[model samples]
Target: MPIKGSSKGIVGRVGSLRGLSTALMLGVALLLVGPVAAEDFPLRDKYASVGVPPVETGELAGSLDAMTVVDARSPYEYETLHIRDAVSIPLASRDFNESVRTLAEESGQPLVFYCNGVTCAVSYKAALKAKKVGVKDARVYDAGVFTWAQTHPEHTVLLGEPLQSTDQLIADEAFKDRLLDEDGFYARIQSSTDPVIVDIRSQDQRQGVSLFQMKDRHVPLTNDNRELGGLVQAAMNEQRPMFFVDATGKQVRWLQYYLDEQGVEEYWFLEGGASKIYEGMGLQ
Candidate 1:
C-alpha cells in the first residue's frame, strides 16, 4: 500500500521518479483489465505497472479449466502456496522460454501467468517473454498469489495441504514490526550487540558488491524454507537479531511466515530491500 496519495509504498522519501515508465505501462494494461478510475490503485502503483492487462475473476469466470494458470514464481514460493492446478515455470530459470513453449505447445490452451502480485514483475515479464518467443496466447495475472489465496482459499494450497484460512499470510502489523528504513537500519547497526545482516537476493539480482562491507552475509532468498530455517537456527543459537535484505521488500512478506514458524522473533526487513539504497523500488 502506497502512502494515501502517493504511488510509493513508504512515507516521506524523495528519489528519482519511476513514474514515467510505470504510468505508460498501466495505461496500456488498463484496457485489458477493464476500465479504471483515478482512484483504482494497486493498479496505479500498488504493484509494478505492466504493459499487459492482468487476469482477474472476470477474465476466467467459466474458462478457468480451459486456460492454463501458470505460476511464474520460484519453486519454493509455489511449494509454500499456490492456486490449485497451477503449474510452476519460474521466470528466473535459464530455460524459461523453452519451458513456456513446451507447456503451451503441449496444452494448447491460453496461458495465464501470475507471481507475487502487482508488486512483483515476474508474471508480466514472463508473459512478455512468452509472447516474444512466439507464444501469443500468453497473459498475466498481476494480482499475485497472496490475493488469490486469501480470497479463494478453497482453490489454494499451502505446504501441500488445502489452505484453510486467510491467516496463512502475515498480518500487516507483523510485517510493519520487521520493517526498517535505511536510517533506522543503520542506527541499529551501531548497537553494542552486533546484529546479523543477511542479503537474501537471488544470484541474478546481486549487483556484484556488498552493501555492508564489514559484516554482510550472503544468503539468497528462496521459497525453500529449510535454507532460511538454517539461518534462523544460527541466529537463535548465537542470540543475535537478524536483519534481511531482498531485491525488493516484498519477498520478506512471505519469508516472514517461515521466521514466525521457526519461532525467530527478532528480525527486520529493509523497507524496500537493498534497491532502496540506490533508488526507491515498487512505484516510487
Candidate 2:
C-alpha cells in the first residue's frame, strides 16, 4: 500500500527503535544491580593497615575488644574507679610480674596497659614489663584515667583522694635538699615547713605498710597516672618548675628526660635519697 522508498525507510526506522529499546533495558538493569568495582589503594595494602607488626603506637588506640585492660595503679586507686573488668596490678608491688603472669595464665588475653596518662610513666613502664613476660600483644594506653574521664564522662569513674608524683615535691622548693627517708620526711612534717610531701609508694603502703612520715601537704599519686596531665598543664599555666623527688633520684632523672622531650625548662631533684632530709633536719 506504500511506495517502495517509504517502506524501506519505515523498516530502517523500526530497526533503530529496537536497538535503542534494548540499550535502555540493559542500562536500567545495570543500575538496579551490578558488582561494584573499586580501585585498590597500593600504599594502604603495603602497610597492612595501621595496627600491624613492627609498629604499635597506632595499635593502642584501637577498640577494647578481646583485650585485657590492666590498671597498673594502686589498689585504693583501682577501687575508686577503673575501666570495668580491668584487672588491678600495682606497679610498686615486687610481685607485679607474678600477678600479671597469673592473670595471663588464667585468662590468656591480649594486654592493654594504662595508668594516670601521658605525664605518668608508670603505665609505660608497666607495658614494658608486660612485654617482657611473654605478652607480646601488650601495648600502652598513654591517655590513662584522666583522658578516659575527659573522653568518656558518661561512664563511671571511681573517685578518691588525689595523688601526686614525688617530683612535684622537689619542684615546690619546700622539700628541696630535704632527705626523703622515713625519719627525714616526718621531721620536716613536724617542723610544719608546709612542705609538699609526696609518697610514690602504692596505696597498700600508705594505709597498711607504714604510717607516712610527713603528712604535710601530702598528695597521693594515684594509679591513674594519666590524670597527672592536669598537674603538668597546671604547672605550665602557672609557670612553675616541674621538678622531681622520689625514694632515690632515679625517678626525677627519668622525669627530666621526659620533660626534655616536651621542651620543658630545667627541673630539679635532690641529690641523695629522701632519707638525707632527716639527716639535714638533725633527726637522722
Candidate 3:
C-alpha cells in the first residue's frame, strides 16, 4: 500500500511478502515521464542489518561498573524514568556541552552515548560533541534506551520512556531494511520534504555518476571512495528527511548507523549503490 506525504508526487509501498524475510526495505516516491519501469531492483528476500558494532551485552553489563553511561534524552524524559546510573545530558539543553566536558575531565573514562531509541539521533549528536571535546572514546549505543529496555529489562528505565523491544523492532513487520529496493529508496526520498541528498563517493566516482537525470546536490565523502565522515555530517544536518547514495550497501549502512546516532528520524540510502539508481535511468 502507498503511504501519502505532503509532497506533490511520491508514494511508498512495502510489498506483500511475509514472515521475517530479510528483504531490504526501500521507500521511494518518484515523478517520471512514462510508466517507469524498475530494472535490477536491489531489494529482494535478503535481510539488511543496521546499527553500531555489537557491544557485547556482557561488555554493556560490565560497562556500568566503571564507565559513565550518558542518556541524551530531554530532562522531562529523564525525570520520568531512566536506567540506573545513567546521567542526563539532553542534547537540546544549553548545558549539554558543559556537562559532557565536566564528565570527561572528572571521570577520565570514555563516554557511552544513548538516546530515546533506534530512530532517535540524540546519542549520535552527543557522541559527535564528545569527540570534539577530545573525549578519547565516544561510542554511540545506537539502539538507545528503547533497545536497552528490551535487552536489559532488569535495569531501571526512566518513567514515560516509550518501550519497543529489540524483538519488537527487529521482528516488527513494518521494520523496513533500507538495503532492499530501488523504488523503495525513491519512496524514502519522497518522504522527506527537503532532504539533503548526499552522494558519498569520491570526486572521481561522483563525476562518473548521475542519478535519474534528476541532479541532486552531492558532497564527496572521500577522494577515492574511502572514508565517509563528511557525508555522514551532511546527512545529519537535515531537519526533514535525508538520503545518502553511495557506491555500496556496506558504506550506506554505516552512514545509516551514524545518522541514527544523530537522532535523525527519517533517512535512507540508494540500493545497489549509486550505479543502480543510474542504471534504472537507462544510464548504465
Candidate 4:
C-alpha cells in the first residue's frame, strides 16, 4: 500500500546522459512536464458531472472556518506545508476512498481539496473521486498550498520546523541528494558511529548473505504494519540517525517520505539499494 510513485521502481528512468549532469537533466525534464497552470487544470469539462467546483484561494481563505479542508497531496508534500488547519488524505493512499467517506459523513461542512499548486492535479482528482463516492460537496482549491504560503504566510502550517517557502520544503524532501553510494554506506556502517542501518527488505529477500553482515535491524515495510511507527519512534527517541535499505532502493523512498512526515528528520537511504551493496561487495 505504499503510495504510487513511492518505490524506486517509479524513479525517473534517465536514459544515458554521461556528459550531462543528472541534476540538470532532471531539472530540465521536470520543466518539460511539470504541473500545469491554473488555467490548464485537467478535466475541466468533467467538473460539472463530478459536482465539484474550483474554489479560488481568496474564497477558500474566507471560507476556511466553514469548510473541511483536506490536503490531497502526498504525505511528504502535506507535511512540508499545508493550510493551517487542513487534514491530509493523500490521493495516492489505498484508503483514500474510505478516508474521504468518513470525513464526509462526520463533517458537516463541505470538503475542500488542495495540493501543491494549480498545476498539480491531486486536489482536482481527489475532489472528483470524493464526489463519485457520494460526497456531493467536494471542492478543489487548485491554487494549492504553495500559493497560499506565498500570499498568506501566517496562515500556513508545517510538520516539524518552520520553513520560509515551498521551495525549501521540496529541497528538504528530496531523496536523491541524500543518497549514499555503496562505498559511502559501507564506510558508515564500518564506523558505526552515527547512522543506524534499518533493513526494510522482506523476510524472503533476506534469505541469503546479508549486507554489512546483517548488523542492521530488520523491519519489513508494509502499508498496514501498525508497529512500524513504534519502531521508528524508538530510533528517534534514541537520537540515532537511520539509514534505510530495501531490495532495489525503491521501498526506502516511501519509508523515508513517511518518516519525514512523522517528523523524523535524521535519515538517509542506500542508493541503488541492496542490489548495489551486493554488487559492490561481489556478493552478486
Off by over 4 Å in 4: 1-49, 92-95, 160-284
lDDT of each: 0.66, 0.43, 0.51, 0.64
Superposed on all Cα atoms, the candidates' RMSDs to the truth, in angstroms, are: 11.7, 27.5, 17.7, 11.9
How high is each candidate's TM-score? Answer: 0.76, 0.40, 0.38, 0.48
Q: Tens digits of per-residue lDDT for model 3 on 120-226?
A: 56677777777776676676665455445555656644232333332322222223454558887777666667766667665657775556455465655321222
Q: Which is the better candidate, 1 or 4, if ranked by TM-score?
A: 1
Rank candidates by TM-score, best first. Answer: 1, 4, 2, 3
Give a tens-digit lDDT track for model 1, residues 1-284.
11110011111211221111110001112222456444433543433344455567556545777888877776656666767777767787677777778778877888898886555677877888998897878877766776676667788767656777765555566578788898898887767286888888877777677888848888785544446667679889988999889887867766676676667778888898878986743534
Writing each residue's lDDT as its tens digit, candidate 4 over 130-184 gives 8888887988887666567666656775443343454533332376766898888
Runs of candidate 2 with Cα error greater than 4 angstroms are: 1-62, 159-284
The TM-score of predicted model 4 comes to: 0.48
Error of 4 at 160 (Å): 4.6
Worst 10 residues of 1 by lDDT: 18-27
Residues 261-284, candidate 2: write the lDDT tens digits.
344453344555444554676856
> What stretches of model 3 exceed 4 Å from their correct place?
1-56, 160-284
Question: Which parts of model 1 are misplaced by more than 4 Å?
Answer: 1-53, 223-227, 280-284
Q: Top TM-score: which candidate number?
A: 1
> Candidate 3 at residue 94, lDDT?
69
Score residue 79 of candidate 2 by CA lDDT. 44
